[model samples]
Target: MVQSQTHTFEGKTIDEAIEEAKRALNAEMDEIDIRVIDHGNQKRFPFGRSRAKIAVSLTESNDETWETWLDNEIEDQDLFDIPLSPDEKQPVNTAGTAWIIDGQLHFHQTAEKKPILVIPYDGEVYNHNEKLSGRHVLKENDVIDFHLETTLIETKWTVKVNDKEQTVTLTVTPGKKIIPYIADHPAASVIEPIVQFDEQVNNQLQTKDVYEQLANMEVIEGIDDAAIHRACSAGEEQTVTIASGKLPKDGKNGEMAFRIDIQERSLPYKEKHDGTADFRESLYIPSVEHGEVLAEVIDPLPGEDGISVFGDVLQAKDGKPVIIKAGSGIEIDEEQSAVIAAQSGRPLIEQSGLLFRMSILPKKRHPGDLSIKHGNIRFIGDVEITGDVNEGMTVEAEGNVQMQKNVMHSTIQSRQNILIHGNAIVSAITAGQNQAVYDALQDIVPISSPRTDLLSP
Candidate 1:
């Protein structure tokens, strides 16, 4: 039996009319054969509606009375192509995006450009399947319906189901099809089905429902869905940090890290005769010996590593090394990291870059008393005191000390011998007490001449 179906359409030309029928019937050029029945006249005056008629029928029989079924299909297609009434035969579908109309959330890099949607499906984020050119808002679990105009793609497929052949209509979409495909109407853009890349979501992305953008084949390619899933699960500023390069730390000049304790050891001001406190004088004199270590350098630290958001590695600046120059009567030991005195003398660190050395004081005769006028003495070499050491004063020497007058109510310390021609008197101060008594006298005599260490001036 021959199976055939007929339909008609009006356009500016016969081809345009036929093309409209093809779209209405949803048929490709090769799928059906057409015989022109009539070419309707155009308006002899101005632009008037043109009309035409054609008979369409299948060409071959792929299966057998499926041929009759094909005839029935043709008749069904012809009925579907015609509207419910003749006046409404021509139906128009305006092309654009469909899903954006009912969307709950929307996003874009800039506020002016078209925004992508983050749709929630089964507790995860997805993008708009439609290639949205403008703004659209979508929310989680919003029921979206893809109309035929928005979702239909030009595609055809067949599958062997139950060991028998069955025609399966395919829509152009992103999914697990594993086949070459285009849409039912390939030119008509489609809204993608939302996809969930992660179970958890990032806070920044979550606030905007942007866990994942529905991947569209036309706009974007090679989307790492798994990577997007991992990013979403990271849930915040958990993205990779760019590696920061290390800077070279400038070397610090070596110096003594230890404190020169002067406050605790210095003498406090006290009252003199008439039980009145002078409240004026306090003294300190620091002394040192030969081969003594005064200062050391600290260990250098290593540089830290840096990283980038894209997972690139960066280097950090390392701490630089420092060297301390030892001056006269001083030695530098690299292994010990120390500046040591070569000989016994007053420990002196010079003004030049924290270098350490020793200084030997010179013997001098003074006309006046060794009181506040001379201040406190810190001599590294042999010292001579011609006048009496007045009350509340300190004289420290690394070498032997020789005095012409007695030391009264003063302190005198020497690394070597002490020679005093007169008495070395010591005194005590008692708070709220009546009397001021002198302690034992200190006197020293040397057995041999001493060696002196001095820095060259």
Candidate 2:
């Protein structure tokens, strides 16, 4: 038979003794279930020791499993719902604020207060919905009435209850209405009319009434001398004083009723003539020897009336008066004057043909000696090499390639034609393979493949 394990500790009260037993068993309050089997008589106990008997029920298991279960129970008991005061608990208002005609809702809140509202309407409403069904203009004495329903939730315990939802209905009747005046069918001011007039003096000269009477008038009878004299006498008195140079003062005496006729005068004609001179075969006559002859004709030939002569004067074959030079030469007639001029040298005439020929070739120096290298060299024109090149060098030219030395492990390409005048070794030739080469050669003479040999050792 197994002996029952009984443990007891004395304290002033049952709670104190049960705490002592819990400490002895190394069990927390949540891990064990305590049952009081006997509350010992307080009379029989001593002054400081009150007798209490109890049994603690706990799971019998390994220390690790027991500790794990005890830790989970402690953690679950630690969480609790904190209580809120009456002032801190309030309701959320769901009805939105009011709005004026052609106006929007504006909200103002203090630091301790929050304004949140929800609106219920007849249609499906989404966030940021705008309503434009009301009248834009408000008239005087107009009433705008709306109802606001605010829901408030007041709690009795820490746990929230849905049945305690309360609503407060608010009816807002806006104050005295003032209507804004909007202009409709506005009137525009009329522009003033402008008047114009034309007159010779202060009186209107071209009057319609006077023109109508003159339109019917005809030249039926000529004016008499007495009538003309009478009309001239009635006019303003005027005196005519003629200038001495403008009018002829030495006119015939007793001449009356003078008449003047004006005519345009014609100008005198002037003619210019260019004298012809030939110096192709004329011998050089010094200026000192022919000083007088030069001086007489130095003014250059005048208008079309003058004539010029050059070179030796000889008779024509027909025996007419003539002059002859090495080339065709002629003289003027006896009525006109002819001038003979002498020149010192023959005139120069420019020849009209090609002047010079030139040829261009690739530079024939090493890259180290020159500013540029000839690796994968391409020429727009002919390529003539006068120096040596290292192995794995390439040359592409449009016209021809005339190399004085050997080209090894290189390439040569041309579009128009190619002529190599040196030995080539281990080189590849790719030309006229595709339409791309022909297309690239339209403006640029030749398109050459890249020289992979340049990267070779």
Q: Which candidate number has the best lDDT?
A: 1
- Quick one: best TM-score, which candidate? 1
**Could you tell me which 10 consecutive residues in candidate 2 have the lowest summed lDDT?**
255-264
lDDT of 1: 0.43
lDDT of each: 0.43, 0.31
Off by over 4 Å in 2: 1-372, 430-436, 440-457
Question: Candidate 1, residues 220-273: lDDT per residue as tens digits?
Answer: 222334544444344233332111222323443333442222111345666779
Candidate 1: misplaced stretches above 4 Å?
A: 1-256, 259-281, 310-312, 350-457
Per-residue lDDT over 285-350 for candidate 2, one digit per residue giving the tens place of the 0 to 100 score: 111111111111111221221111111122212111212121111121224232222321111111
| Error at 34, model 1, angstroms | 63
Shift in Å, residue 317, candidate 2: 54
